[model samples]
Target: MTVETPPERPPLTSVDQVNLSDWDFWARPMADRERAFALLRERETPVFFAEPVVTYATPGEGYHAIVRHADVLAISRRPDVFSSGQGGATNIPDMPPEFTEYFGSMINMDDPRHARLRRIVSRAFTPKMIQKFEDDVRVAAAKIVDDLLETGPGCDFVTEVAARLPLKIICDMMGIPERDYRFVFDRSNIILGASDTEYVPADSVDGIVGALLTAGMELQQLVQDLAAHREANPTGDLISSLVNANIDGERLTMQELGSFFILLVVAGNETTRNAISHGLHLLTREPEQKARWLADVDGLAPTAVEEIVRLASPVNYMRRKVTQDIELNGTRYRAGEKAVMFYWSANRDRAVFADPDRFDITRHPNPHVGFGGPGPHFCLGAHLARREITVMFRELLTRVPRIEAGRPERLFSNFINGIKHLPCDF
Candidate 1:
């Protein structure tokens, strides 16, 4: 998979490189990410300076940049030394100690506990289960597209279609009621928007935090209610499966259920939303590549989705705390320090890619870190995410002619990367 980053504009200066605001986590625009990574890659070392305490793993006391593609693989694979527990899970400014207590959550846990929780959740998100949801995703995507078509051609696609579609689909899979969609959406915005000033915004910070706390409690309560319901009135939705599921012959605790729900909501909605919005924006920006797919009109949209994920790299990076003193990417760090794997940078490493900036949908040997990481923490929702994007492109590229980018609004956060407004005047 020899891909190349096609050269473009110069990297942003350090002043422009600093991330600020509440929405920086999941809503950072694709263009800004390219600028930031381009600057981060300019230094001699593949890795460089990222103020750890300020950017990622904020509560803890260390920061590192394993910017190269190879280094990301090495650190991710060796979870023993680079434990995911503690401040690595999120870049939250002042991480509440309460959140870390339930540190056994799959994303933060290492070895036995991580393994155990992953196993429990893995059963529900299998290929077979996703296959069952294919029609549901298509139906939902079609409805979203049709709604856009109904309102005429020119529309802000990201806000209307991209953000809402997957939110519904994931909620459906999780067995959350439709009445709760607004609530779920609110909390997702808050938790993911915690970093950048753009997404959650200064005015909404208090509301966002308060909403997130309430949302977590609601999820905990819902899981218990659904668990009791499933025990008596067993239906086969994800919630039911979780309630009835047995790990080591025991059901998960309320805290475990909350974390699992958080995982699905945070993981499922934000990434897919970014991929959809960013993909549309890319097609508009790169006419030649967009034209190539529009001409094909068959399964080519799926290929475009892959390119979007590869190039957009919606997940900025997943942080890990080093358990013991270790050396990686020619840099050394002590125990309890944080190593943030900058996926956005690694995906564009010059050494691993040839002319790495070019977007080639038909790039045959695409070994992108967009989905697969080197080891166990690979995204469980990869299949489902792919389904949502594929269905969307199939509906969108065919329905909307000349879907050009019209000034994408950026999210201020550094964690969850995405576009807020992709106004397309089709």
Candidate 2:
């Protein structure tokens, strides 16, 4: 898994190393991150540094940012060594154990626990269910296009278009009431957007922590209520399936159900919504590429979807803990140290992608880590996310041929590459 590193530039100073973990560093424009990671990749393929202490978690020695594609893939494959359970899922410092378990879903668990939960949840998304989901996606896409056609030539694409499909699909799949969609959407945004001022406008640690706790509590209460209702009156949705799911006489506890719901709402919704938003932005920026795709969206979808995922890299990074002392390439990592796989950087690594920076909708051999690397942790929703993105774009391009997106109002965070809003015209 070793990569040939470029010759080191003048060694990074203490100040330069410190910036790597600072939230302000991530809040900079996407291009800034590109330049920073490029410099690190060339001079220090696997750099070790401490994470900046955020208001929500206790400060501690941080992680090694795995920037190369080979290293990222290798680490992702060997989940036993680079364990998620030892630390939390995000690159942030550790939170209270209860908080981590309540919010981390199966993602933060290792081995048997992750395996058991995945198995139960997997049953709900069987081939038959996925086919139905795909059909539902197409119908949702068509309806979205029709609405946009009636209301546009102009709208906020993030709100009016890109964000709608995932939200609707997830709510319907979970059997959530239509009235609760806005509440679920808001809470999910707050949870993911904790670092952003728009969601948590606090200068002090206590204020930020308070906001986050409040949001988490509300979401948890809602899910718990829903679980109780589903238990009493089951329906043909994911919640009901999870409510009654049995594997060797084992079923999900109320706590596990709540966490799974949170994960589904955030991961299932945010990843695809951001990808669709970024896809519109990419196409608008590269009309030539847009034209090529518009010429045959259905034909180009397989590759186009991969390109969008790669370029978006919506979920920026996931943290892993070193199970024991190890050396990667020339860098030595001790047991309990953290490794943050920068999928955003790996997707653009020259070793894997040709003309890595270019937006090529027809890219082949696109083994992007956008869904995540191989392992038990690879995204369960990957196929569904792809279908949603493919169908939505196909419908938009085919039906609203003249539609275009303007500059995005980006989300301010290091964890998620989110687009808060995008002005668009048809």
Local distance difference test, each candidate: 0.71, 0.82
Say which candidate scores most in lDDT.
2
lDDT, candidate 2, 1-426, per-residue tens: 011222434333343543667666665556667777776777555777778777556777767888888888888888878888875776457756657545868988898999999998987665666788887899999998899988877689988888889999999999888898889888888878877677666554557667666777777778788879988899888888888878898899988888888888899898899999999999999999999998887999999999999999999999888898877766787888888898998999987899999999999989999999999999988888988998999898888877889889888777899998999987
lDDT for 3 in candidate 1 is 13
lDDT of 2 at 346: 90
| lDDT of model 1, residue 363 | 68
Give the per-residue lDDT digits (tens) of candidate 1, residues 1-426.
011233454544673454422233223345655666666666655442445343222444436766678888888788888877655355523356655432236787676877878888898788998999988998999898888888866778777888888899988887788998877776776666654455444465454445456656665666567667776787868877877788779676667877778777877898899898888877887889888988886757666777789888888777777788987666787886767787877888877777788887776566678874778788899988988888888888888866677877755556656676787777
Candidate 2 lDDT (Cα, 0 to 1): 0.82
Query: For model 1, where is the 10-residue window of minimal lDDT?
Result: 20-29
